[model samples]
Target: MGKAASALDYRELARRRLPHFLFEYVDGGSYGEVTLRRNIADLEAVALRQRVLNNVSEIDLSTELFGQRIRLPVGLGPIGLAGLTARRGEVQAARAAEAAGVPFCLSTVSACPLAEVAAGVTKPFWFQLYMIRDRVFMRDLMQTARGLDCSALIFTVDMPVPGSRYRDQRSGLAGAPGVLGDMRRVWQALKRPSWAWDVGIHGRPHQLGNAVPVLGNDSGLNDYFAWMSSNFDPTVTWKDLDFIRSEWNGPLIIKGILDPEDAHDAARLGADGIIVSNHGGRQLDGVQSTAVALGPIAEAVGDQLTVMADGGVRSGLDVVRLLALGAKTVLLGRAWAYALGSDGQRGVAHLLQLIEAEMRVAMALTGTTRIADLDRSKLVSAEAGANNRAAALA
Candidate 1:
């Protein structure tokens, strides 16, 4: 059999297809991207034992989450402005996620309106909130989500103030580029004629789906983002979470948690689950990688709340590392975005299938027949001071 395709192959294709600003916004991380590098390094350091002569016939990948049977344990985490990646980006992503038997989360800053996206897809997708300062506006957004019959609301408590993503500032992502920069960006757009012809010219306008009357019939795209940033809530706290609980009754998930203490706080606030994330290393630069922090948070509050994790998850092997450490499910940020930017709906579907296929092989090599059988025992702690931590130490 020929060699399985590498993620870099897909990434390279995506890079070539996307405009410079959009690609950098999705790919770049905060500060020096130290946390980003650490996220991958820590996961790669984990060693799984490959057993020999094991009967590996049937593989069961199905798992239940929030009363839904997911084909795989991975789900698409909400990313802002995903629609910019492709035409009707949120709708395409949701449809692809649903087709793959997984839940697609719509962001507060998505391109399509909530009703429009809900109308476009048949499946009940999750909605993410970027809580703003205006209480009335927030209420209307929640009401809209409820009216649409959304399955869950993932309250992203991470970005009260947007991260200092230097890359984005450098790339002029926030608004219209300067004269020379605008010309360069347009030139970059021409390089990907398909994206320009399909999305840029013929597709529906990209507008935030969840923003209600504020963005209602906004005159231009610049006004939309200006309104979003100006009104985003900066004083959000644990008590604000309580207020959210009072408003929305569907399964409530608190995303943007990195510390175990915060995880405990979220569970105590009646959170059904907590996504242990550093916002994909987008928010904090010096923070501990989410992969490294997943174990402690899981051990701390795994019983109280469903523990999920995300950050630097580039391959199926990374998923195995996260699960072995104690994550019930994992979220992919750039993985799906890359697919959307490069090949539209089919690309995202193919990417999910590829990850599922890789999970099967990883499980087989480790002599596990089911995803539930994956445990810490299957993993030997990385060689510690030249000692066999898995065999020699306890």
Candidate 2:
């Protein structure tokens, strides 16, 4: 088989495979997408100080999160309606993650059932949770994940309400009509002949796997949406964290922490780890990029819990940037989705290979032998100075 190239290769391929509506849902950001643009720009600004004539042997990218060992320090982040991107997108993505020796996190809103994905991958993976008001429903969801042998539970604290993705509105995929565009997304779907043939004709177009039992098939997509809007336990408090901790009995990671204080709070609340993320600029607009906040958050509570960050992570070099800032792992949200959209399982696997190759090449260039050897000293940008401040704050 021919070798795959870059993340952009996968992205462009996905653009070709998925319909315009589905692509926008995964690719677009909220409001003006200022945060989205910044996430990529800020990450790019941190340049790696390459060194020469150093012993670069055995570029080990393996990392241990909670208790599970992964091949790399990057894992696929949760994406809602991932299946809509491709035929059974979550399963395909999970299979790719398994092939790469990293964890694939399934969203609470994914189309494939949790157990089915687990059965597809033939290994333990991480499950992302969106706490709901219904105790019985939440318990069942947790039980399903547990039965599937998921190693950890990532409780997403963000996404209490969906963000206003103007691109999705423009793509004709969104629920509401916006001043920016019209809702005739069906025409765009007609244009994507591949999707209408593969995704639209072959299987279920869009369905929330977790909500199937609750709303039942008669409920349909509209009912699923209504149930989720009403069901998610948005009034979630720290005390609720304790409740989740009691239930899962696994590594409980609290995602969506932007502030150092909250990172510390996640540690105090019995969280096994905390992901410093801004929901990929999909939630609040004009927020500080996760990369900008990572170093500080890592410094504040790095010793207490695992420090991971996600937002605008496009390449392996960005992985190094995050590691320098104190992130043990970097979550790939759009990158994985981009892969899924492009060529389904093959596309995702190719993207993972590219990232790993990029990271190994980067390690050789930086004259570093191991991931732990990387630190602030390698980065000359002002962000490194900010990371230092985050450490001081802690």
* Per-model lDDT: 0.82, 0.82
Q: After superposition, how far is residue 215 of candidate 1 from its true place, in Å?
A: 3.1
Looking at model 1, report the run of 10 residues with the lowest lDDT sum: 1-10
Q: Which pairs, if any, clash in model 1?
A: 111-207, 113-209, 132-233
RMSD of each candidate? Answer: 3.1, 4.7
User: At residue 189, what lDDT does model 1 achieve?
Assistant: 78
For model 2, name the residue pairs that clash.
14-341, 14-342, 132-233, 296-390
C-alpha lDDT (0 to 100) for residue 304 of candidate 2: 93
lDDT of 2 by residue, 1-394 (tens): 2334778666677777677777877888899999999999999988778799988877888878777778899999888888777787898999999989888899988888787787798889888988788877888889988987888899999777766778865665656444323335456667888877667767574578777887666433455546666776668788888778768998889999999888888988778899999899988999999878888888889999998889998889888888988899989988888877777888888888888989999888998878888788777767676787799999
Kindly list the per-residue Cα lDDT of model 1 for residues 242-304, writing each as its tens digit. 778788999999998988889999988899998988888787788988877888899999889
lDDT of 2: 0.82
CA lDDT, candidate 2, residue 296: 86
